[model samples]
Target: MTLTIFSFISFTGQKSKFSDIIKSKMYFKTKLKKIPLSLVKQENTFFYFTDENPYYFNLLKSSIAKLGILNPIMVQPFEKKYYRVISGFRRLQIAKELGFTFIPARILRENLSPSEILTAVLLSHPHPLSLTEKVRIVRIMKDLGISTSQICTRFGSFLEIQSPHLLEKYIRLSNYTPSVLSYISTHGLSLNQALAFENLSSEEQNLLISLGTCLSLKGYDFCNILKVLKEIETKEEKNVAAILKETEILNVSKDVKLTRSQKIDKIKKILKMKRYP
Candidate 1:
């Protein structure tokens, strides 16, 4: 993708809060000034490609087509005339598609480690991870021999996690089917939402994919969630059958008639309407 430059919204707006989050999470609280998009730069080493990444070419094309770069991309200064994308692969790709020569970016200094840069990028430009992204981050960390504590520390604090146990489930998601994983990515499913599919058989995982959609239980609380789900497995095949009985809502309840297509429809409808009703 090419570089882009669009209007920069303030840090108080919904679009702006993520930039604030990046500042708060990274503990880098400078007066974040809004600048014209022209000063922003793009770097070459910011992304590693795989056909598997949803932020690959197609979605990148679509995001640019629809959002018109709704969110500013992240960047780190490189040399005299370039910036690296810490995140916002879609924005970058779209910029290229839209024929933009420059894009909005947050300029970071040249000397940050990969993890630091990623953490900065996440803090600066978070997309509220799909279960797949969260799992991928966990896997990325473990494979690279990076500790969660370090990621947590650099990202700001491990304490901010509402469900720390999610770290465990995230690492395990790599074991699942690619199709199953794609369902999460396609739907913007979060770690918590993915747990709704957990303790489920492969067949159940498929069912949950159909049931959950891009709406229902956008994500789950992996820590408190899976723990309670494990405890609720009073039947054979806790991996599958257990979810047939009870369901965790906020890691609190295990009883809900969420089966059947109609019920799934209702669940998805209610997901965004209320606060975990």
Candidate 2:
């Protein structure tokens, strides 16, 4: 019911610098109101910030179902009659699923720039974000014409990224297949390990994903496997998929008798032998 101009300056400490950047670039008024679900567009405009994990979705749904929406979803006016979601995408989805005709929303004017909308969305979440979320954010910002330097300088501290090179890694990750990205997110794959697959063909990536899943690979083992594969690829001048197929790594991956450790050990041995021999 109350309309107020959001202030970025209110956020202090490390966020104060980030707030200053947003404050200098954009300003928009937001109104707290109950908007009809029909008037709100279901499509996500700032989906980079959204958490796609089913477990988290169910948890959020349960919380909303029990307590109702304690916080208003943020939206921006769209197509004269409808509103696009800037943040709280999960909340909006859950609200619609629960058959709520009207949900509480903080509506921004249609004139807000993409950067402004994105900043508001980013500010909506005060807590730390997941690696996948940070990756997507950098990607989206880059896509919006923000330079990598600006992204690192403005968001690096807030995102807890230490350097521009690390931020660039996140940018590169945006180009990976959804399956690879999802695997990296769920498996806790290091940035280095994930980027190692960047040069691989789609088929090669798929093979590695299958191998990783079969072997239950993570951390150092995964990195070492990639290293060995690259070495073999370089010496033999063969693609990873071809190397894997030739060495029967796929079959080894599927073998029921071999334990995970045994499979990994055998696979590594095969790779080393192929590279050396």
Candidate 3:
């Protein structure tokens, strides 16, 4: 198999600018070598805290088949015989499935700590990493005893997280129950929605999940309905299952003529009346 390698070129007047760019954390030595795919192990910190999305796997496969991997997978020596994958897990998986015996890989420098390796992987990823993947990175950083403030200072702006508390919120998601995580993943729940759902009792959550499945609510509608159910449960001292069956909330949700926004508004209004009356 032919190995693809990356290198930096110096332009006449752009030399200084390129040098400065290389000095930034975002720039790394891109040179790569082709190594036996079987020698590389998927032992990166990212594998621990999140599940892979099969949809993304297929997308990656198609991209690789057409365009080939634009970036080299990062790896480091491990156990003196094997290399550990630091980033590009999905790409590696797809490459193997495509019957590639050897893969392009960049070997990370020696003596880096786990946190540093994790940081390098995060900064070097070619594709935009998912929020859940990032959360798992932060959780690992936390496990390595990095302070929340330090993490924010280093990655907050890049990850678009505004505050240390907000970063903490993402990290906490790693500790949510498996069923809840599965629900969040399968339904494509946003971070805000997951955070809201995380606060409910397991029973309340299961009922809400059932309600979503039953009504065939999609995307934001499912989240909004859950939020409404949560509000009514809090104020009216009722369970979600009871509210769905005993009240007209589910009926509002299933109404064919109402737009999704209208349904959300109606559900909120009905919940308010239940709380007040």
Candidate 4:
């Protein structure tokens, strides 16, 4: 990704707010250069499992195919012959598909620690990131000796996270099963909804995914369904499949005539009308 110039000029021998203090110490002087595409390797360890944003990737690939890459990717030297990509993964991938041998990049100076490289990645991305990406970054920071409090303090506003308390929630989200996580990624599962699913056994989580697909559940509907299911489980102390047999939710979800909202509404009414005794 293009490492755009960020102004840290205020910290140059002038008194600044406490917030700027930590950021001031972490600046890297980057230089723009053209690096061979073959030399840059995609490293998986930098972040947790993140799904490709196909919409963005396609749009980017199409754009680069026409106008060429408007911005450079970020890289740091790995071995004597290869460099590792820190950001702009999609751009690099698309560039390769377009049959280009080299791409523009800003190569960081040598001996930068993993934390520093990660910090630069966090700072250099121009747009808001996906939740998985955020989780990945936090997971890596924790891996590299940065505390959650420090990460929230320094990058919270930039990441658009509500609070430091929520950091743990995202970290927990990172541990979800890949299938469930993929569903979460596709359906845009909210924090509460994801946590709700986390309380389930692995089998139930998979069932939830199946149930969601059958119903074509929206975000609000998904949360509501989970809430009702959770309440029923708590009240009756039964697993999800047993509870599902108690209502027509599965059958109702399969009906093509009803809209998603109508499905959720019907399911809720059914759950509310039934008694577990």
TM-scores for all candidates: the values are 0.45, 0.81, 0.67, 0.75
Off by over 4 Å in 4: 1-30, 41-45, 48-51, 245-277
Q: RMSD in angstroms, all models? A: 12.0, 4.7, 7.7, 5.6
The model with the greater TM-score, 1 or 2, is 2
Steric clash count of candidate 2: 0
Per-residue alpha-carbon lDDT of candidate 3 for residues 56-81, written as tens digits (9 for 90 to 100): 67887999988877677777787886
The Cα error of candidate 3 at residue 22, in Å, is 8.1
- lDDT, model 4: 0.68
Winning candidate number (lDDT): 2
Whole-model Cα lDDT of every candidate shown, in order: 0.49, 0.74, 0.65, 0.68
Q: How much is the lDDT of residue 3 in candidate 2?
A: 11
Task: Flag clash pairs in model 2.
Answer: none
Clashing pairs in 4: 1-73, 1-74
Give one digit per residue, the lDDT tens place, for model 4 in 1-277: 1111212221231222323422343433345678888787654446423466678689889999999988887776767768877667777888889998889887765676666566556555555677766766666667777677766655565555547679889878767777776677778877766777776788777777888877766578788777777778778888777787667678887778998778777878888775433
What are the per-model numbers of colliding residue pairs?
13, 0, 0, 2
TM-score quality measure for candidate 1: 0.45
Model 3 residue 192 CA deviation in Å: 3.3
Candidate 3: where is the Cα deviation over 4 Å?
Answer: 1-30, 46-51, 171-174, 178-190, 206-219, 235-238, 241-277
For model 3, what is the alpha-carbon lDDT of residue 223?
71
Cα shift from native, residue 79, model 3 (Å):
3.1
lDDT pick, better of 2 and 4: 2
